[model samples]
Target: MPAGTGGSENYTVGQVRELNRQGVPAQVVTVGLDADDGRSEFNDIPFRSLATLSEVGGLDGTIVFVNEPHTVPTKQLSYLILHNPPPIRDEQKAFAVRGTRNRALIVTSRYAAALWARYLDVDVSTINVVYPFAEPCFAEQPRPDTSAGTTRVLFAGRLSPEKGVYTLLETLHIDIIEQDVALTFTATTAGADKPQGKIIERLLGAHPGISVVTSRKTPATMAALMADHDVVVMPSNSQYWHETFGIVSVEAQHSGCRVIASDDGGLPETDCGGVVLVEPDNAEALAWGIRAAVASGPLSRAARQDAAARFTVKQSVNALLNVFAQPAPIPPATIIRQLEEQVLAPSAKVATTSRPDNVLIETAV
Candidate 1:
């Protein structure tokens, strides 16, 4: 069940769509979002809600793929997908408490699993790492050699501080100007149209050659963009948002662009020999990486081959099904007790002490 928009939700939808296309009888069950129950369509996959799951004969034999393990229900078989390490202190507790309810924990990379194991204090052996699959369109496309003179650099994702958009801009301003380069910044909204958004607009406006594309691009569009660029920079900051898996990095590599990513979270894991890893939150390091990437020229055949070998939809689907096939280890009674004691306990004081007028506290028996 997908719970929010981003890479995780996109992965969920992609997996379900692929599974259904492969005649696996898979469908999406959206959680924490308003969707009608039974036989709805989203992203071309059949969707059903938690309430109408049984009506579709899902309850007889089913596994809930929970994207975020917050207030997890332990009655049914479940697999928790831990994409990123808990982003905040409260989420750490929630992940730890609710993670135990799952039969298996899935992660996109080994680094992600390790982070989860360390953060949740769970056995390392219990977590499963299923690398995300890039769509077929993301494969290498024949493009012109962009290695000489000016390098075309592309930055894709949210235009927020957490995404290191500002840091990238700073790098371009300070160091990258010496090197002839073309930079493009694309996102849904410029930092939700905040002051930083104004800063981005000004930066782009002042830099006459720099380009900005404003739209939410699909995978095909992103792949097209990657195919044209010489380098793709994903310089996310760990303190702000630890990137779970650099799916876009993989896409770039597959599309024949050299990737320069931060060595925070799972970007290193996703770098299958074609990526240059740099320290996060450092403009100097990022600039160094960009220069290094440009010097190295376009991705070599060997590097491209290795990068494409890292993940595939077939491999990911097999891994997911394997996890679903396994039975849960913990009893339902134990999970309920853990939820009441560990999950709800921390929130109890807050619930009683002070709650906003808009907030309503509800308990399930």
Candidate 2:
């Protein structure tokens, strides 16, 4: 499902683990460029490479759900889950082609389903909307009395520009905001080869007083930490990878923390109540949202109840099963021609089903 151990991959493993618990024969086939195959266990399920699975014919009749179609096989019952808002024209063309080759297309938000349907040049009915879920570990925590002063704000997930880390830093720098609030940043992108991580590092270096919590925590640990915070900020920018299904915001809401997130991508669709939406990449708006959350107090019992009722692993898994039960529709002749002309042109790198390296695993970051 995921190429590496990121948010999407982590969520996939959790869902698969739940599926396996409920008597579903779900196994993880991690598709990456790493060579020298080695076996590992994730969420008590067998984690194998695509190469190893193909050698044993394990892919036969398996419904492969992928976000990155570039690196995965277009085999039996492939469900392409659209996540990234790609900016590159060539990448968009390639992604559109790769998506159509799949048997079914899956999207988390209605916004994504509509955007992708237009981008892929398909009817809106063709795409299925199945919302993402937070693991059961993210339960509500006891809220601190806001009247006592010192509001705690958190920004979790990848330290990338698309995640609005830069915007959060700028908001913190503004002098007009209340000084009673303390901010914290967690999660490290030590292995990710992204410029956002470097930018976050420089920002942290400049503002040493901003707390740095330990990164790379287990689900329970992350949930516990989230429960301690009063407000969680997710100010994802639309310039590059906008906040697609803001998982951290969902987790925070479920954990009894008020959420202040950018109204970009699938973020607005997470209207489960108690979310304070703001404009993306705007420091003033983000600051206002944070301040408003501090004054509003903790999430109401109804909001927390709504989160529990709607955003559960069981609901997501059952929807996925429904999607898998249906038969795949055939691609149109016009779509086939577009794929042949644009995606497989002389300038484009030809894709092959035989090679596992060419198979991309979309992380949906």
lDDT of each: 0.68, 0.68
Pairs that collide, model 1: none
**lDDT, candidate 1, 1-365, per-residue tens:** 32223577557777887888788887666543447422232557777555432333334445555555544444565666776666567856765556455456778888877777686666667777888987777775666665446678877755666777767767866646445545443333434456776676666656554577653335676677677787888889877578888787887888888888888988887776678999998889998898898678888777777777767777788888877777655533364678688765544323332376756665433
Residue 299's C-alpha lDDT in candidate 1?
81
lDDT of 2: 0.68
Of candidate 2, the 10-residue stretch with the lowest lDDT total is: 33-42
Regions of candidate 1 where Cα sits further than 4 Å from its true position: 1-5, 31-43, 50-60, 72-75, 91-96, 99-103, 144-148, 176-209, 331-365
Tens digits of per-residue lDDT, candidate 2, 35-81, equal 33223324366666654334433466555555655434534546666
- List RMSD in Å for every model shown: 12.5, 12.7
The collision pairs in model 2 are 68-362, 70-360, 71-359, 71-360, 72-360
Segments of candidate 2 deviating more than 4 angstroms: 1-5, 32-43, 52-58, 71-75, 140-147, 178-195, 332-365
CA lDDT of 349 in candidate 2?
A: 55
Worst 10 residues of 1 by lDDT: 52-61
